[model samples]
Target: MHDLLRDSPSSSPRGSPYGPGDWAELEEVARAGNFDVLRSVTYNRVWITGQSYCRNRASIDSCERHLQSLWYVYYQCARHVSHESFEQDRWVLDIIRTRGRGPLTRPAPGGGIDIARTPEGTVWNDLPFLATDMTEYWINSCAEMDSKQRINAASFLAKLASTRIANDRLCQIALDLFRDTFESERPLGSSNEADDENEDRHRTIHGLTIASLLPSACAWIREAGHNIILLSDASWNDCSHSTIGTGGFTFVQSELGQRAPGGFSPWRWLYWLKRLHQIAEEASKADEKLLAEQAANAIDIMLSDVKERNSQILRVFEGAGDAVTQDKDFMGLKRKW
Candidate 1:
């Protein structure tokens, strides 16, 4: 199989360089349930093709054909194959990590290669077969990634989060990543306007992308009976008190005051809160009792926090004397609150 794939011409008129006869033989191997051999050959072929493409030695079409072959074998024997086998494959992890490195040196002169445009990125974005493992890998890797790579990773995970295939583990990973990234103190703004603006843009992009994961994560929590205690148990110790506390209802509330320090703007905070409110309302209408109650409690806590913040602002105005109350801006602020 390796020889056949390696020796195949890139300009073949067929969709794949491998002819029908070659596929038939491969299908026969699959029918015989020789998955170990098939998997080994498939990974080897994929790695070679991916490397060739990354190095600009192979066409995108050729790389895509290799992925097609992988999907073919996976679909052919999906029932017999264990997801763990695919997840544990070193080749799979290598392919995922490759995204972090961006495309290898291209012969043509351009700026940095867009990893999202690469075939491996296509595998990360569109292939549902390995979505679970990919999502987990990216979530864990996001911490060490540069801002751009983190944004890309968050974008991929957000798409996965919207899908029905997102499981509890993915939700847990997303939550942990969110808390770890946002709860930490961010760097103080620099005097360089360009640098500060760029930093703010990255923060907004990252926050919004990560926020997209919340709906699905909340749904999973609701399905789990809103079991905050179970979620924060030793087995799931990575889930911080700020995250699983209140069954994830306090997630946005806890970060509401973190605008300047945590890099989330007030608008972004409101967006997160709005999403939680929508989820809570949906749960109530669906008669998800535990989730609705937990969500209501979270809403109450959020309101209390907002009121306290407003009170603090009012005190500041009062301390500024009667002129501050008479100021149009102060009136606007009061009405806005």
Candidate 2:
């Protein structure tokens, strides 16, 4: 499964090739991923507390949107981490690269396929629900660009937010089970554990995960100001107390860390994350190709050794059958009890 998920064009190191065996592994990864989604949505309980969503508008329609974002966003975020490429996924990579370029149809320079402004089967329409702090992000990154271009980028991002992209099937299935599992509406488990415990645990884990995504992104925000943006949902779930903007299924920390100086523009913070992902997209360029090839070779060697050893063990077992025929439990047949 890891192999299949890691084999995406953006994830694969540039110029590093995969053979038949590698492709076979990718197939297995896809198969396993599908099953994982099925099991996760099917068996998992409502992930977020309704009280959290209700504080704003417990009304039926708003609650439904919250539920949609919870399951859909969480699944997408998890994929970004588990599948590597910082879990940005393929469609996002395209948008980041060609965002303001308009509906691109020309081939990418290195034979990479061009991603249209609004690709079919994408989450382009769902951008508004993404809830990332992009208003500030636009200003920081496009400070020099004209307003029209900034608007274009913003539109692109909004589209990206709304589309389910890779999450269509999972969302469809999870939606079917929503009413039964929403934390507020969900039936109590065998043990009626308090919701406080669940919320606390999620908060702690989420904070750590978002914090960890930063160091990698610092590499890309070189020209951007010293603003701290909590990208995507990093600041989600925690946004109840903060004044922030979220869109395109991403989050940026609008407020400063406890010890840090005051917060900067939201756009400034998020620009860093976007830049960081762009850098990652190019990580597999020529410089890393040699290492990737070596890794591939090493895997083949290990597999070959394992195959030979298994055959040798089978041979030993098969030959042992004849020796068994000449012996008894503890002695030759003549001396057996």
Please report the candidate that would top TM-score against the real structure. 1
Pairs of residues at least 3 apart in sequence or in different chains that clash in candidate 1: none
By summed lDDT, the worst window of 10 consecutive residues in model 2 runs over 175-184
- List the global CA lDDT of all models: 0.41, 0.27
The per-residue C-alpha lDDT of model 1 at residue 106 equals 45
Model 1 Cα lDDT, one tens digit per residue, 1-337: 5444343323222234656676666766755767667766565555655566665456665566565555454433432333234432333343344334433334544665534244233533444234444444444444333333343344334333334232233344444543432333332221222332232323432333222333223332332322222232222332223333112323335433322222222322333344446555665666655545545554454434444445333343345555545644234234343
TM-score of each: 0.30, 0.22
- Give the lowest summed-lDDT range of ten residues in model 1: 188-197
Q: What stretches of model 1 exceed 4 Å from their correct place?
A: 1-16, 82-107, 114-337
The sequence of per-residue lDDT tens digits that candidate 2 reaches over residues 154-217 is 3233233334333222121111111111101111221112332221312321222211222211
Best by lDDT: 1
Root-mean-square deviation of each candidate, in angstroms?
Answer: 18.2, 27.2
